[model samples]
Target: MSNIVLKRWKRTEGVVNESYTHSDGHHDQSTQLSEVTLTGHLGREAQSPIEMTKSAGEAASNGGDDSHLPNTLTEDNRNEGEAGGGVSPCCNWSWMVVLGATLLMCCILSAFRCMGMAEVVEVTVAWGEVDPTFVLLRCRQLLTNIISSCFGIIFSPFLLQLHTSSTTITIIYSVLQFMWNSSGLFVGPLVEEFNWRKVAMVSSFLSSCSFILSAFATSPWQLLLSFSILGGFCYGLMTSLSYLIIPHYFTRWRGVANACVVAGIGIGQMIGPILVEFLQKEYGYVGGTLLMGAVLFHACIGASLLRPIQNQTITNTSVQLVEPESRTSGVVTAEKKWTTVAIRIFLCVCRNIVTNFSVLKSRRAVIIAIGGLLTFNSWLNFIALIPFAVQAAGHPLQAASTCVIVSAVCNLVTCLAVSMLSDWSKFSMKGACMTSTAVIAASTFAFSVVTDIWWQKIIMGMWGCGVGSYMGIYGLTIAYYMGVHSLDATLGVTQLLIGLGFITIGPIIGVIRDASDSYTFSIWVLAGLAACSFILWIFMPNTTQHSHTTPLSPIT
Candidate 1:
């Protein structure tokens, strides 16, 4: 007769969930059991959820025959399930979504980083003699893609014709930067109200419109309307939405998924300059602006790929549940009740904003935000600084561009490799952040002293390694520190910090270069910023304790 027996079989100092059927005092068929069930049985035997979950994961990973287990046991999913109060399985086709996201990310980053940065150089060249302040202001603003290709090319001629002062241009871009950064605050509510895919599609279409509007802009204010206000808002919306979509699809490969998506930024950085340069050269800036609009419009194609996952249970506490309104016996006319509904909605929104802002109260969120601010600001400066530094060291502009490409390649590779390692191995997210920041500090210091073209390329590669590694884990770090539910709010806070840094410190770097007539001091300052971020990261709270008190396990 076939019999069922519940047993915890320990072999050579490790636990394995196997059901051995014993009949007639002899063993017969043995079948593997689910890790979730195994953990529950162990839990009754006084085993902590964290310890049992980790042991089960280790056993599965350490060559245990888990072929019979469900495929939902993804890399980060274990922790996600434990913390979330139930074991959820990942969808089998999630990889298809990842592929789509990578393409979407490529288009987003290309427009946001690559095209934005290139436009600054193109605009300056087209206008031929502006205040040194214009380059500094626009370069920094464009880092987060406040300006697009069409935005700059269209505005360059108008500014020249109108004789607008650089100070006025700086003020305009500063407002754009603020708008871009502040728009993040609204993302969480928008995503909650609408499907993420719908929000992305609408924003992508509007972003393309912004670029097209810039191509025909006649005045600086028109440029602001098309490029600064509209473009900046759309970019911020799309960028935040991209980060939010990944965690929903893949818990098992969350780290690797983040790396793959962010690698699009590297790809865009590498390809954007060359493509825009060719378009502007071949078609002229006006035609280039129109062509660039055509390119930005393709983001809609990327947005179309973000299909929503079905049949998933969301246990995240951050996803607030709304209660249905009670029915009233007395009928109220629509016009009479409109004001009451509007007032109630406004009050509800205010509560959400207050609750979301409370995420900043956690030390973990603050450190993540501050560290991101320092590291990101330092890297953006490097993008603008590297070209000037190379020229200062006697290399041509071509050499500088080549060095930027080298950094991008290294960034892409390291980002992928490190993210995979973090998933497959026991490397902590905090450790990855610390190690990469140190590399950036050392590389930046070395670049300040090195003059040879080969050394510059090598130094740039090292710099990219640090930047990419940090970026790879940035989203994971947020999910780890705070729950995934708080990700939008935390990301919004980080964007605000980075934006403030751009406006305040970006121009200071330019002034230092101009006054000192050397990039050496400015480079040292950036290295110092990297060092500061490393130190700030060292204070990150120990989240391991949460595994015991809560069902979630710390991400390995």
Candidate 2:
């Protein structure tokens, strides 16, 4: 004999709490907004809007079961129960995970922001002095370390000789950006093969080595090997890892947790310029690069703190392997059995790859991807070229650094503000994304036209706002269009596409500078590219109304 007690409760602040008491001496409680609770031994709580719909569908298919509640658990719910068991217990330690991830990201952003674009003007001048064969033009682009055009500025008389140098330098920067963005294509699979902690630690070590190697680079090609190829790949791995791990530990606080992790970039941006500037002043570029290498090594510590959690997919596979086979079945050969297992694993991987690609089937996701590709270089180009542009307009490097600092502050403030508002149903993340893109476009154009130091600073501040807003909402925007289940795959696929775009578009920007003898036109072209994304995003369909918070479910 069994009994079940169901109670309908009042809604409180848009959330409804339902409690179920079972004769098995267990209580099931769920907290959601405007959703009916299903009956089971231990009723599992649905975490997101998608899960809510799924729960409702499952309940309806079983005839609502209000009068005669089912005694047995469904296979799907049982599996969920097992998986949720591992994650639910780790929420207490989630904040610690955030702290560790924050440290890792802070190091990456500091090194990349400082070494990539912020210090490119000074570093380019220093590098050109060491290798006088290449013409030193005004440092044009520094995003991903675009440094050769800066050489032309120092040796304008040798502009004719800059074609090779500019192209080669652009290639180096392009490869770095390419690897950084495109690595996402396979990073998802790599994470699944080996947990996030191992991937992050190994990558962080490689990144440190890359930076140390950069300190001893004799020519552009050496920088290419150390900084562009190796460093970029490692950075990409950690970047994807940091974003992917947050959902594993967070459910209700997903938005805030993500914001905290991403805020590391803003914090790094603010610190990188000042730190690198001091290091550059005290020690030359070589010494600075070496010390920065040390600073980046700490990421290994942060990566180590990511405690491993149970993988439900792996658990399911283990269960199948141990299931007893019919004794009447003929014995299988060792070689044949191994081959069969390998084939099964390969097929499973292929299926996962296909599913990852399916996110593109959504028209809105495609638009977002295209928009990302078109404007991929906006932030990089704007930040990278500004210092060189400032110096071109007869301002000091200090003034340029000041502008970068101002932008960084604004970026941090705006990012935090947007993150705080993430749970607000009234706040439209898509609109914020579009508005930020437009602001970046306008600021890029204005900064290119106005050479006045004060005006440039003001323009930089505005650009910082746009940068902050975009960074704050980047992940949320992707999940918004593709759904939470597809977040990791979408990031991997979208970044892979944008990485390819850098390969083609990066060189063209360099050539434009070489041909026209100025970065103004390149800036204009970037602005136009940003505008293109803004226009495309305008057509994106509205998503179902819900708070844009990441659910606790593992991204499959």
Candidate 3:
């Protein structure tokens, strides 16, 4: 009985061990099946999304895959969240659009600048019957310099042909100069509120109409009404717009970009004389004036190219939210409360003006403005004095004009080269400006002593180099010192000071020429001013030496 019981126990124990082994095998198989199912589902879901994202990215990139785009979009999307949908804050196309707008602006500005200084002499010579008095000639020189420097160019063949008195023309031109300078104050707010393209289009239309209408003017006042008032106002708008647009497009290459755009002045100066000379020769002044008006119509095409940037659009939207409610109110509400709305608008404008003027409190801005005042004063004197000096030295009007063209060509080359140097080398904007001022001073002193025509031409070329360097770096220096945020206000204030110099100094130089019977005194005075500018530069601050990669912040 004991043997039988022991066998039963052994049998039961073996059976239990076999059952346990079977259960463990089934558990291992189930676990493997579950792992396979999960991997299959994950592959199905993730594969499509990855492939879709890759294809969409490729399509957006056009041809090549840009590694930078992914990171940029990621960062932008993170910042902006779902509302932006991974859109970049600034696109590749933005810089291209800015470049195209800059080219257009160059064309318009070239036409404007060329028409003022170079074409005036051609028009005066072409209309032979008009005998302008000394005062009239002096006034014309003064007004032309003032108007052109302030970014307005006016030419009415009718004024010279109709035998208008120099006094009347002078008065009209002065009023026009004032109008052009004052128009700038309104441009900053307008550009910030509306699309720049729209502003440019309106300006182009007014400019074109002004030029076309001046061709048919029968009296001096009519000419002034068309050319001086209408044209000057529109041209001022265009000039201010050009300066404002540049900073938005570039950062590291700002100096080179500005140089290229400003070089349009040289191009216009080179082309204007030849074109006007040909037109006057082939067609009379009336036909020439009419054709020039047609040429100006092309500015509208340029204006159409100015597209808004993404960052600027964002800024505009934020500003609109804070703007006076009257501007966005219903027509009936605005009409019922017209006086209140008007008061709000006036207060808004005044507030904006004060805000813009706040940039002047910066020590860097003050230094630049003072330096620019002296430099521009000397520049105006050079423009007015060079032609007279050449004439007094027994050269013809053509020779003087040729000298102007030469100076412009030299200016174009020098600006491009110097800007390139500034970008590539360790040279600071302030250092370049100081060196340029010194060169100008030396050149001006040379002009005071030199009597030979050939030597004068050489001196003029050196002077052009100095002027080009100054103009090329002026905006960049402002960006360097006062920061990019303050560029618009700094430019506006600096231009106003320069305009004052053009208006005051040109007439004073004219009086000096009449009294002294020589440009020796005038040239010496300009040299002294240029030297003073250099001295001012030496005392100003230099913030670019250390931390070259860090951007300068604007003064509060």
| Residue 483 C-alpha lDDT in model 1 | 52
Q: Residue 109 in model 3: shift from native, Å?
A: 3.3
By lDDT: ranked, best first: 1, 2, 3
Q: Against the hidden reference, what TM-scores do the models get? A: 0.73, 0.67, 0.70
lDDT tens per residue, model 2, 1-556: 1322223344343333433344475553331323432221012222221222112223234341221211111222223333233232354457777887888888887775544333344345545542211112222233221111112211121222333355576466567767888777665655543346667899999999998997786667777788778988888888877776675455445568778887776676557657766766787667877888898999999998766442211111122343356433434554465576566546644555555665565566577788878766666656756666788889998888788768867877888788666645466767898999999899989999897899999998998888778777676666555444456677788888887776666557767776887888888998998899899988876544222221223322
Model 1 TM-score (2 dp)? 0.73
lDDT (10s digit) by residue, model 1, range 63-92: 423222222223334444443333212244
Separately for all candidates shown, the number of backbone clashes (residues 3 or more apart, or on different chains) is 4, 11, 0
Off by over 4 Å in 2: 1-89, 116-168, 212-223, 270-294, 308-355, 391-397, 513-520, 545-556
Better of 1 and 2 by lDDT: 1
Model 3 clash pairs are none
Worst window of 10 by summed lDDT in candidate 3: 1-10
Cα-based lDDT for every prediction: 0.62, 0.61, 0.56
Q: Which ranges of candidate 1 are over 4 A from the true structure?
A: 1-93, 113-131, 140-164, 274-291, 304-350, 545-556
Best by TM-score: 1
Query: How many clashing residue pairs, candidate 1?
Result: 4
lDDT of 3 by residue, 128-153 (tens): 43332232233232212123521112
lDDT of 3 at 225: 89
How does model 2 score by TM-score? Answer: 0.67
